[model samples]
Target: MHSEHPPLFLKIAAWGGVIFLHFPLVIIALYAFNTEDAAFSFPPKGFTLHWFSVAAGRSDILDAVMLSVKVAALATALALVLGTLAAAALWRREFFGKNAISLLLLLPIALPGIITGIALLTAFKTLNFEPGFLTIVVGHATFCVVVVFNNVIARFRRTAYSLVEASMDLGADGWQTFRHVILPNLSTALLAGGMLAYALSFDEIIVTTFTAGHERTLPLWLLNQLGRPRDVPVTNVVALLVMLVTMIPILGAWWLTRDGEMVAGGGK
Candidate 1:
């Protein structure tokens, strides 16, 4: 039996839309090797490792990359802990204002990025807190938690209660049950959550702007590159590098969460 699909026009339109969306990225990746001066000429005049070498020795770019990695790692770890706890609490029992709590958890992701950035800035000003690596981590974690929370909550909802109860019946204490059983069950969700957190932190610029007073991350570095046209192709190289750095975690998370099968033997 043949299953009905979208019309030919719709299929073409879908592919067209994808191409329109990603054409610039393709260009950026291709021009990374162009040895020509500042201009990004198609069919690049000559291929060279100048920019790649430049990116390697550039201390500022290296520092930004290091900062970005630190922020993403910290944010992901913090979000994993907080989000997992929140999910566990919600899964354990029903409570008053559950919907409100859940909505609040989701607000950071739902609201405009500018709004979140501004809000973080305002809060930091009110607290008289200095914007730096710490601020960046906090800012990223605020949203990262939601990514983790969403994944864990969905996983918990589908989880069988019998498993936890069985662990308890086998004389497992709360911490032991969680460490051995619950944590294992949530391993995949936690992994997915952390990856999402890392990816989100990697590309985040608006919030970083509010939180970063002096130190620059890779995204901020890229933003600064925009003012100088001479470094345009160099920017493309850094952009490609940035994309690769962020892409791995998101892809890993997608693969892990897509099936949710890995979580089956989690706690044991």
Candidate 2:
């Protein structure tokens, strides 16, 4: 016989971990509404929406937000295309250097962000590529591709190859089969991967710092605000916005993929 429930201590430990990770976020949210701007205090002075209005009127915040959104969108798009193609090529195929290729694909994301950022910065300098918007997109796409590739390839492994064969046997052309059969089966995985990739890119600071030159994405702007203590309330508001933007997509991705093993046309 085995226990069906975790021990009480284990449950307590789990909840403790959750609180430790998220208590700071709760504090950030509380501070976003704090009326006192000088320094963060316990229990918060009082609640007001003044900071939200202040953030709204700031052109720099708006510009940073817009840049972050644009970079995230473009990076996700690039990741979806490249990652899907890579997964399709590798899913049921065995060839020379396949494992090596897979390892290379995952290396960017597996390494530390600072390492990846440094490597990208060095490569750009070698190639005489200016550090700016395009570099930022490329840098972001490198890791974003890994997120999409993992999601899609996992789905591919679960999916039956016979679906493609059956479509062909039913007089469907390659494009038609892919459009009608494959796309539907891949829809959730692709969407989840895209959302995850977008969220990752949107909040990324290290790689963007190395590649952005003078460009300020939302994360960079928030980082710069650290030096301006007077902007604490506005910074809190922006931080809350960033958290919401990243967290929502992450939650959406989790919801989309929670039942992923039961994907359409899966199994033998």
Candidate 3:
């Protein structure tokens, strides 16, 4: 018997779809190496590393990059803590409105960015909370929690409750069981979740726009650069850098989360 493969037309369609999604990213990356600083001419007018040097030297861009890094780091940290707690609370528990609670937790990521942004903005105004670095971190954390929550809850569902029961029977307290037993099982999932949350927060624009009062994060900086044709090449370099930074974590998360046999004689 011969193994069945996808039809040739389907294979072609899949490749075409991948190309369609990635071709623009390739163009942006290519433009980063263009020698012509101002205009995007055909053939790129030759290639050089000048824009990279320029991007490195720009203080404003450096500041924006730092701000984005700070915000992403803070958001990811918050998400990991909160999301893990939420997963632990909801796991293996049945209650009224549980589904509703889960839906509400996912609302930030499920809704359109603009809608989330507007809603957050309105809430902040209502509460008299000024928008700034803290607000930006809070905004990013809102959606970031969903990523961590999804990864954690999925892992939790797969985890065997018998192990936790065994730990309890062995005189281990809740903290000890969680620290030794559950933590090991959840390490990879938490890592992948944190990485994904960091990536999302790093590149977020819409929610950041509403929450960031004077803080100019890297994405907002890129948006501001659109009006300057002379800085196009430099901006492209920055954009490429951002893509690479975000892509690594995302790819790492994907690799970590790939389907594989779970460790035997463990929670999951």
**Candidate with more favorable, higher lDDT: 2 or 3:** 2
Q: How well does each candidate superpose onto the true structure, as a TM-score?
A: 0.93, 0.95, 0.94
lDDT of each: 0.87, 0.92, 0.91
* lDDT for 71 (candidate 3): 98
Among all windows of 10 consecutive residues in model 3, the one with the lowest summed lDDT is 259-268
Residue pairs clashing, model 3? none
Encode model 2's per-residue lDDT on 14-107: one tens digit a residue. Answer: 9999999999999889899987553477768788899899999999999999999999999999999999999999987999999999999999
Query: 132-160, model 3: which lDDT tens digit per residue?
Result: 99999999999999999988888888899
* lDDT, residue 154, candidate 3: 82
On TM-score, the leading prediction is 2
TM-score of 3: 0.94
lDDT of 1 by residue, 194-261 (tens): 88889999889988988899989999999999899888877889999888878899889878977664
Better by lDDT, candidate 2 or 1: 2
